[model samples]
Target: MPNTVASKRVHVAVGVIYNPHGQILIARRHDDAHQGGLWEFPGGKVESGETVCNALARELHEELGIVVHTSSCTQLLEIRHDYTDKVVLLDVWKVLEFDGEARGKEGQPLRWIKPKTLTKYAFPAANTAIIDAILKPRDSSFSSH
Candidate 1:
């Protein structure tokens, strides 16, 4: 007899913490955490009853000790990838400003790297496009009065 079961997707929040220098922040996952020792944007899973933006704010504060105003975050992209054990949907955002300096509150190492240098780091599969998008310059249009 064959067994039937369904796999549930896991939802996570990710932040592209940037500075005026156009550097993006990356953090090393704790050795004991999932995908440990790998580098990624500083963020984590969204808890129940929390909006995506709210989760981003919370995760940033918890992981980096920075308090970001939820309204200031801009939705950058969403990534969906499948792992052998589970499917993950990462909601990524770009935080332009926040309070306090980012520290590895979780005992992880953090670095701010230019977008051009991101390719040199080994990130989870889902972050590939996110990095590309971050490197691309935003389109701007102006209207003359």
Candidate 2:
């Protein structure tokens, strides 16, 4: 049978939203959905003709009820991953400032966790890079001996 899933590369915008307390926000993917039951940074697919940062700001507002200034977004990293069904290019950003409280606007479970404790939760394979990127600075501050 022909592959039902589209082979097109998907562009996604992910936000590692941070609060004043040094905690980052995460959300649980729907259990029955793709990469289900995994904790992921909140984001969505970037529609055609949309800039990556614009998409990030749009998704954040639509999914979390927050208005983010695209100009304030810090481009952090980009990850490309190919899953069995499709391929995705994840454009990750660090969002430290925004207006409004973040809630599960989509009814998904959301929580805040310290970056150093991210390993305690289960995440999709693509997220490993993000986790490492988030920890690199902290990792350097610790004594290696």
* CA lDDT scores, all candidates in order: 0.84, 0.88
The runs of at least 3 residues in candidate 1 whose Cα sits more than 4 Å from the true structure, single-residue gaps closed, are 1-5, 137-145
Deviation in Å, model 1, residue 92 alpha carbon: 0.6
Candidate 1 has a TM-score of: 0.86
Per-residue alpha-carbon lDDT of candidate 2 for residues 1-145, written as tens digits (9 for 90 to 100) = 7765666678999999998898999999988988799999999999999998899989999999998866667777889988777788999988888899899988899999999999999999999999998988444324432
* Ten-residue stretch with the least lDDT total in model 2: 136-145
**lDDT by residue for model 1 (12-124), tens:** 98999888798989998878987788899988789899998899898899889999877778888788887776778899888888889999997899999988999999887
lDDT of 1 at 27: 95
The best candidate by lDDT is: 2
